[model samples]
Target: MTVTLQLEQLSIMPGQRIVLRDVSWQQFEAILTELGDHRASRLAYDNGMLEIRMPLPEHERSKVLLSDFVKNLLEALDIDFEPFGSSTFKRIDMAKGIEPDECFYIQNHAAMIGKRRLDLTIDPPPDLAIEVDLTSKTQLEVYRVLGVPELWRYESGRLRIDVLQSGRYVESPISPTFPDLLLVERFPGFVEMAATAGTRPALKAFRQWVKEQLQL
Candidate 1:
């Protein structure tokens, strides 16, 4: 006798992830459909590997706060952007798919505005993506295969910036998006401040800091 379990039957606790091996593209699509849009767990698929993760409350808090910082930075600079929070981006040809914690279209904002759906074959990947790596490590290879230009990963109270170069990611001390601002140094402090001083106050202070930087 043999028994098989459905995806729905599996319960993924917060801050935990389960990897499924030898998963095909068609099966991945079916799993996405079964999971639907209103779910909390995030998924990443690369070649024949699939990883599903459930974010803890701490993970979510950091994601939201840091995402807010991105928005505030873009706004202060008066730059146009489109925030696509945790949207699934995939390409069948590459056999890769990933859902970012938060993503933004800055340079490519004009092209993505008002778009209801994404087709990676024709449309360009997001200009920047944010990943809160408190729960499970982010799959950098998946993002690279999908051709995301920039990625920001936050872990252990520090932020790491990576820029795609020659089809690979290189750790950079400065962000290509905000060359004038020192986000790698400043963002972590603000995120920590948010944890103790509260979101709104921390954001308010961050906005002031950005304004001060502009004056310098």
Candidate 2:
């Protein structure tokens, strides 16, 4: 006897994830359609492996704060960017897909402006992708296969910068996008500040800090 479970029947608790193996790309697409776009959970699919995760409150808070910091940095530097927050990016040819906590098109912002749909074969991947590693580890392989230039992973209250170099991610001390700014050194503190001092106040303080750095 065999039993089949509907995607809706499956319940993933906050800060937990469920992994399914041997899922075909077609099946992945169906699952995504079934899951729809109005949920809090995140999904990652690499070839035949699929992971569905439900984020905790802390995870959501961190994701928003970090995304805000990135926006602030770009604005302070007077760089134009298009933010695609948690939008599912997938390539059928590559057989890989991921929804980042926050993603931005910085260098290729102009190309992506006013785009409603993304065709990875013709369209470039996001220049920067941010992942908050609280419930599940980031599937770097999927990001690499998609050819993302820069990946920011926040784990254990610290941010790790990884740049795609010759088809593999190499850890770097400084962000390629903001080499002059010490984000790895400064961002974690501000994330913590948001928890205690409130989101608006922390963001205001961070903006001030950015101004100070720029003046120096």
The lDDT for every candidate, in the order shown, is 0.91, 0.90
Error of 1 at 109 (Å): 0.6
Q: Tell me, what's the RMSD of every candidate?
A: 1.5, 1.4
Enumerate residue pairs that collide in model 1. none
RMSD versus native structure for model 1: 1.5
Cα lDDT of model 1 by residue, 39-86, tens digit? 789999998999999999988888988889999999999999999999
Candidate 1 vs. true structure, TM-score: 0.96
Identify the runs in model 1 with alpha carbons over 4 angstroms from their true place: 1-3, 134-138
Model 2 C-alpha lDDT per residue in residues 64-167, reported as the tens digit of each score: 88999899889989999999999899998878999998899999999999999988999999999998983444478889889999999999989999999999
